[model samples]
Target: MHEDEWGEPGGGAPSEEHRDRHELSPHQGSGEQEIEASLRPRKLDDFVGQPRVREQLQLVLHGALGRGEQPDHVLFAGPPGLGKTSLAMILASELSASIRVTSGPALERPGDLAAMLSNLAPGDVLFIDEIHRMARPAEEMLYLAMEDYRVDVVVGKGPGATSIPLDIAPFTLVGATTRSGSLTGPLRDRFGFTAHMEFYDSSELSEVIRRSARILGVDLREDGAEEISRRCRGTPRIANRLLRRVRDYAEVRSDGAVTREVARAALEVYDVDELGLDRLDRAVLGALARFFNGGPVGISTLAVAVGEEQTTIEEVCEPYLVRVGMLARTPRGRVATAAAWRHLGLVPPEHAVGAGTGVVVDTEPSLFEE
Candidate 1:
């Protein structure tokens, strides 16, 4: 998160628009939105995956309801599409309250937050998506709201300023972030509960794909669902998207039924490999292996060779690769593991990383570069 003056965190919620406001990102298409919305679990009971999160959230909500008070502020941290947003919506739905949805970038000034906070109904849920990126001033405002349900709005300019204390309706704040580590110490400390969403394994992802298919009226065979699940990179959003794409392929190229082979072909056309390597993912690996001879090269150099941002390479591309054993991030730099070469359809050199060949490069590369 960039260090900037933050705005206050208050907003009005006349409707449930806040719950649906976070942008899904570049790969999220308009046509699938209806189906995606339809497929979202409305209640915690229906949510799939993240069993630990479900249990913790259930306890928090039930405890609050029993005490006849608003639930504590909740923080959900994980990569996109692991159901952080869905869980927020589910909490609101279960509580039978409306939710206001906004991202950190949307709340630019303290006044922006004050307007929203001043109008919330008691027991409402205000979800701040990508909250780690919120402006510094707004984040400061949120501290009081989360802890005390109060905000101090400064009226007038310069030396004539006056701090006006505003009492907001008791409401629940649900904050979601991909990088919880980036959150300020005070902000992170204010959360009553935090859930770390992990990637769904193949079985869970298969269940997710099958569930979406059932709702969308697609006839997906058991193995077909598994095939799609395996290539989804452990993300439900990608699994659903691939299922829709495979459904199209099935209808146009086959008998309108999703079989394992059909799923394979559809994903191949989409350029998603069995290892779930996309264009950018493969590019990072290719550059690391081919150009750098299996690496010890700096991340910046690898990003340069691939024409990508260093952060994108480190944050987005490298994590999955390292998780799946296809890449390794050494103190020296990024090294292509033996599995990476094999996945890219090349044999590992005798000098390959972890190959016990012991052929070191002329110069060891540092992560920060020269």
Candidate 2:
């Protein structure tokens, strides 16, 4: 999923070696990376939010450490920017092991995964982000490696192929995916622990903003932090990004002091409204409410109307919109909820699907209905 970019902290261009070509980070640059890394909590105790996840992880890590063995295969399923990456790093730190970071899309061939697996030291943490996207062959190879710590390396083709079992180090696997439902049953079952990351509440997000502001040395007031947090869509990454933008505006527009009014003004300039909806978000809602008259329109049609990719609208924008009760996915198509129309300052048609009636009205005309 693509996230909005904040202004690059350092002027240097992004380094290809440090990031995947397929994946897009919020901000990029060796210097910018360092700044982001600095903001991440190094220890489990230092991590904020997800109280249940933090406690469960501590128990798992401690139990393994006490037994003098590697921990079980862990799976983190959640939306982007809820600290899945951070928790993986923290797990490694807690175990005092080195972490090898890679993503599923990068492991196209079994050989690619094999090479990485072979090089891992015992007790190392192998973090595979977007694990659901891994190639089928590599994923099959991983099954054995994850279960038995051995991989069958095929040395030839067809009838001449010979499977050679190679033993790998006893390491831990940490797989993260935004779409847990896409994971195969066998793969999901292999994980000893699976943590689902939830969206933060306003209070939690406000705490995140305050913590981030301190780390970045921004002169922020509580009200300013709360304002930014409320508009961040319950994501810490967005909160940090918005905080930086507000800080920039405060420095140039005022005296480097971030207050509630300053934050509102900055977000207005950036086109983020109080409900955390941006231009694209509003565009989607507007198209549904105006063009389709609160549609049961197909996602494809909506994408064309908004000039956005189907995946972008489906993955990035739709989740929050649906969570906020502004959108609904129906068997027929996508429909705008009554709350959506009201949010856009438009009235919902009485015959609309989500017009606060118990029944669904077909907005589209039927040829048979004379």
Top candidate (TM-score): 2
Candidate 2 lDDT: 0.83
Which candidate wins on lDDT?
A: 2
Q: lDDT tens string, model 1, 188-254? A: 9989999999989999988888888888899999999988988877777677767878999999999
Writing each residue's lDDT as its tens digit, candidate 2 over 119-159 gives: 99999999998898888999999999999999999999999
The 10-residue segment of model 2 with minimum total lDDT is 7-16
Report model 2's TM-score to 2 decimal places: 0.90
Candidate 2, pairs of clashing residues? none
C-alpha RMSD for every candidate: 6.4, 5.1
